[model samples]
Each structure stands twice: as C-alpha cells, then as structure tokens.
Target: MPSVMEMKPLATFFVSHGSPRTLVDETPTTEFYKKIGEYARREGIQGIVWMAAHWETPYDTIEVSSNPNPDKDFVAFVPDEILDWYRSYKINSSPALADRCCGMLKDAGFNASLNSTAIWHQDVMIPLRWMYPDSSTCPPMSLISVNGRFDPYFHLKVGQTLRSLRKEKILLIGTGGGIHNLYTLSWHHIIYYKDTTPRTKPIENFAAAFRESMNESVVRNEGGPGLGRAMCRLLKHPHFLKCNPTPEHFLPMVYAAGGCTSYEDEGSVNAFGGENWEMNTQLNSNFVFGLPKDDTIFLGEGS
Candidate 1:
C-alpha cells in the first residue's frame, strides 16, 4: 500500500451500480466505473469507505461492518455464471477503520455499532469489482449502512460526520440509482421485448426530468453544508416519488454529498457519468465531489 503523502487527494463519489449485469455489460455507466478504477490506481487511493442503498439498518441505528472477511450477499437476479464469476475473487476489509467510523458516528450523537458478521452485498461488491477488477489490488474497504428511516437529512449529517476521512486519502463512495422505479421499469421492459428487444428501456419524460433535476442539483451546488441542503430538497422534487418510490436508493446520494464538503469551502463537484438510462427508469448518474476545478482527469469533453 502507498503512503498517504505519496498519493493524490481523492474526492467523494456517488456511482450508480445499475444492476449486477453491470459486471458483464459494456455500457456507458460501466465505462465510467472503469475510469474511476483507473483514477484510483493512478492516484494511489489508500482505502474506501462505502455507503450503499441495499444495506439499511432498522430504526435510527446505523451499522458498520467490522468483519475482516465478509461473505457475499446479492439482491438482483444474477445468473449462475455471473454469480460464479463474482465469487471467483476475494474482497478485503479493514476492521480497525470500521471501528473508527462507528466511533465517529457515535460521537456525533448517533446510535452506531459494529457487526463482525456483516456480509458484502452486491451494492457494495459490484462497483468495487468494476473499479478494481483485481481484488488483491483493491483498497481495503469499510462498509457502512444507511438508516432504515431513510431521512435524507440524517444521512447527509452522517456523511458530514465522516468528511474528514477524505484528508486521510480514503475515497468515500455511495452506490445507488439516480432513478429507480422497478414497477415502471418492469412494464417498460415488457413493452420493449414485444417490439425489437433492446437491452435498455426507452427513456421516459418523467425519468429524464428527474435525472436532470438531480444532475443540476449536484453540479450547481458546492460541497458541504450547501450541497447537503440542496440534496435534502430532492425529496420534494415533483418526480421524486415516481423516480424513487422508496428512499433507500436515493438516500445514498445525500450521504455522498455530505462528505463532499471541505473545511476551506473549496470543494468542487463533477458529474462524471450518466449518459445512459437503464431500465428506462434509471439514469445511471454518477458524481465526484471535492476535486480541484483544474483537475481534468475525471472530466469528459463536455463535463
């Protein structure tokens, strides 16, 4: 592992893992994931602290994984071959860092605890696999869960609590969809299959609107308190319920936004991906916050 001083500073990221299919598909979102991996390797990121939409603790309590070697747990319907491919590699973790995260949350007046038996769900693994194909070279990860209550403000506060981790050369990531309405997505898939069978669903007006609103919110706002305030407003967006029937998936974005804040208030935000919408309802939007404005490594031609 490289020392912290030898590595370039990292920004907090919110990446859309789409589905387990991302592992095999060569879509724009997956390509963005590959770029993130390339950047991490080039910058020598020391570790990763992740928050995912899939794992949520009950009530106001937040759980952190202290397991040195966690097991696999996937939510999407991945085929046997894909599952086999995923299991072929070993992902590592850091119990010491996990404990430290729990401490930070508890000090902030939140009920937080450690679970040594925590499992690595697809939400946590899929992006990691894509970002670091070689598990052995992957940074040591520490998984944290969002509150089941799904209060956007609460998760934002949690991210703010851990923002200091960025100075440690740790990359904080939130993995969830920009627009995730499974019901609408299922119907769209059925409709498309009857026509010319396409891999992705047709983009809906409401979905596109929601995606644009989200992108604007991230790009227009600065990191930290202002960004957190902007993210909280997303809950009140006209298409919020339509795009996100539940708060679990969308809350991770708020969490990631909170950690993007910096002490000097100079953190920059870049909408690194989201050129394609998946399942019609999901805009695979991803963002990186706290990078310098002149840093062009993660920015694309128009970004």
Candidate 2:
C-alpha cells in the first residue's frame, strides 16, 4: 500500500440524519444518502473514515476494527440481511492504515492512538453498507469518541491524523449536522405538517441561516472567526434545541472543516436530507471547498 502522505485528497461531508424514525421513511434523506453512495462509486473511493455522533469514547482513541470476525453484527440499526452480507465479505481492515493515521497525528503535535473495538453505531453506515454490499469498495476506519462532548482540538487532531489517508485514495466523512438540538425539535414543534403551506417558520429560518453560513464559508474560503460566530448563531436557533439536544451532532462538522488544508481545497460539502426535502433540506447546495473547479457532478440528484 502507498504511504498515507500519498493518498488522494479526501472529501468531507456534514449530513443530517433526522429522527431515527426517518430511517424507515421513504423520504429525501434516504434518497440523498443513496445518491451519495452512487457519487462515491463514481469518485472511486477506496474506503471511508467516518466520525459519527453516535460513537464516543471516554478518552481519545481510534478504533481499528480487528475483530477476528470482522463482519460480526455491531450496528443494531441495520437490517439483518445487510449485517450478514457485511460479515460474509472479507473487507480490508488494514492495521497499517490505522497505525499510519495515528502516527501522523502524533507527528503533527497531537496525542493519538488506535483501538480494536467500535465506539458507537453510526446511522449513516446503514445506507453506506447498502450502497456497497460487496465490501470490496467500502472499507472504513472507526474513530473512538471522547465522551459526549464535542472537542474541536481532538477532532481536528483526528482529521490531521487522517490527512495522510486522503492522499491514499480514502474518503473522510464527518457525519452529523450543522445545527442539531433534539430537545427543542422533539418538544417545541413538528418537522412535517399536513397542509405544508404555513410551514414551520422556525425550522425554515434555521435551515436558511445554516445554509447561508455554509455558503459564506465556501465563498470566503477561510471563514476562521466568522465560522465560529455562524456556528454559535446556528446553535442558538430554536430548532437546534429540538434537533440536537447535545453538541455531538454539530461538532463533527467543525472538526471536519478544521482537517482541510484550506476550504478552497476541500471537496463538495453538503447535507444529504431529512425533513421537507423540497423546501428545507438544502440538498442542491453543491458547495465545494478545495475541490477542482471543473468537477460539476460533485453533488448529484437523489435517485
């Protein structure tokens, strides 16, 4: 295998997977993630390294799936059929790759190491496994979470550690949302309405602000303090309290952004889907940071 430094540039994504109940819904979010799988196939991604909100550790650790039965059923959210397929296929869980990522992080003036067990079960993995059932093209790297808190420095270090992997033809995905506060959403309002005319103004406004900040980040190419400020505003949005009671959902995006050498060099950063896809889900925002100017198909329509 090539050195981590030689890996291809990685694409970072900040997606929102609304209500675990949404998983069973045949809506735009499901379609969006499916389309993302297609996009990954076209891009020829060797494997994916995901930072999921569902997974967190008491300490900073990177888990290297080394189960003798690497395919054992670990994620309960996925169907049994998918789990069986994952178990049967012998995907490459390269220890060398994991080591290199950890080493790179340590070399970059940060503390890092690897673990052999999964820290959490990510919802996105469900669609990802379905998209590449063969397992030949969808190997993954699991990062252990540090408590439930969203530690920017720790995540930034994780991204920096994985920097070498990007050049090695791997894709680094930061799976979460820009503004998520489940407490408020689950209690304050409803995401879906019967009439749809008098839509939830609070949610709509929140999504708009989130998109505006993301767009501004892409345009400015170096959002620095502006990004932090925008994120604060997003967190304060009423919907945030309902969508994400904790910061875990929102922090992954920040860490993912910090990993990039520059926004101008990052690949397409966009959301998948969740509620009111046509109205609120900014799926068409093909915002690219650090991606080639000629790459127009970065974000594809839902299948």
**Candidate number of the best TM-score:** 1
Please give the lDDT score for candidate 1.
0.77
- Give one digit per residue, the lDDT tens place, for model 1 in 118-170: 88888777787678877888888899997748578789888888887777878
Q: For each candidate, how many residue pairs have backbone atoms clashing (under 3 Å)?
A: 1, 26
- 1-303: candidate 2 lDDT, tens digit per residue: 756555446555545544433334445445556655775777777666666666565554434333322333344333466446544655555565566655666677654556665433434544454356565566554443433453455565565556556555576666665545433343222233322112343446656666565556544553233333343455555655444466676666555554464443434343323333322332222222334434444433431
Q: Candidate 1's error at 246, in angstroms?
A: 0.5
Off by over 4 Å in 1: 1-9, 74-81, 187-202
lDDT of each: 0.77, 0.49
Each prediction's Cα RMSD?
3.3, 6.0
